[model samples]
Target: MDPYLLNAPWVNTLRLVLEVAATVAFALSGVMAAARKRLDAVGVCVVAFVAAFGGGTLRDLLLDQRPFFWIRHTEFVWGILALCIGAMLFMRQRHFEPTERAMLLPDAIGLGLFAAVGVDIATAIGMPPIISVMMGVTTGVFGGVLRDVLCNEVPQAFSDHRPYALCAFAGGWADVALRQVQAPDWAPLVACVVLTAGLRGLAVWRNWELPAWRV
Candidate 1:
């Protein structure tokens, strides 16, 4: 990977944009889950915060980075809080049913955006391709895992049997491959997001599932 390509100012801007979008997408998914559970306002906010920040927080910890991402960008905290309040009010006023199906779109989008951001960051830090891919998967999937655990259900990533994390894994590899070939600086990120989200959306629409273990 050419270090200069990833370090460009516009590429940095793109990464920041991806991170913000991913945060909002995951936060919305958390809101839907809380609503589906008929939780109170505080519960809604808590779940939203966890879903928004959990994965990135874990990644930062493992990377030994100072000042967790959200801490470094305190506005993320306020944004999620505002999103929670607005989502709750809008859902209630519109009599919207926050079904599981309703949550899938945002979850898939967040997975893709987070996966791209993760791979880019890891690659920029000179991590090996395998490690970068794992970081992407972690950043994409762990927050939803934490969300489901908080909601008192087995994580859908593990239990749904759909191609959730697999999408991220494939996209991560795509990102790495593109960088290896010296594709345009933005190509990896765009390819990662599109391929990951497209695969996940297709899986959900087609009701595709991985084989479950037999006892």
Candidate 2:
């Protein structure tokens, strides 16, 4: 694949799509968390916005990108707000249970999507591979960290003893590896998303856990 293709308009469009999807995923996770905590509508909206934008905002700041991603993409703001309202109404109408278990899928999805976007953006800016990977990890994990803190719980990325950030880390490497070999522009992104989310879902299904540190 031509290196220039990475910056092609279609690639940018795909990145925007991934970002939008990831935002929606994390926003839903926040909505579920707020609902589980029995927060009011304003609280729900706040949490959802935080979960949706927290990681990406931090990524933008670290990259020294002005205006932040949400600020530049105002529709994303409106969309998340509408999503919060619709999600709340739908859950209430359906008597949906907003359990921790219910939040995992969307959280995993957001993690993968954000990780890919973070890595790609960093790489485009000519960051070293390790730095790009770390950016991916940061983008993947930070949002949920903020969400859990707001909910007065330990961030599951640390406490769950499952491979949350680890999944993102590995997915980041997979992306870097693909780019090294000049794979198709979209291949790295897809591989990162699938590997990260698939690993997370598998870990949940298998009840896999990393060994806990003993005092």
Winning model by TM-score: 1
Write the residue-wise lDDT of candidate 1 on 79-166 in tens digits.
9999899998798788886677766787788899999988877877789999999999999999888989999989978987889999
TM-score of model 1 vs. true structure:
0.92
Worst 10 residues of 1 by lDDT: 1-10
lDDT, candidates in the order shown: 0.88, 0.89
Q: Candidate 1: lDDT over CA atoms?
A: 0.88
> Per-candidate TM vs. native?
0.92, 0.91
Instruction: After superposing candidate 2 on the true structure, give the runs of residues whose Cα lies further than 4 Å from its correct spot.
Output: 1-3
Error of 2 at 137 (Å): 1.2
* Candidate 2: tens digits of C-alpha lDDT, residues 85-113: 99988987898876778677877888899
Say which candidate scores most in lDDT.
2
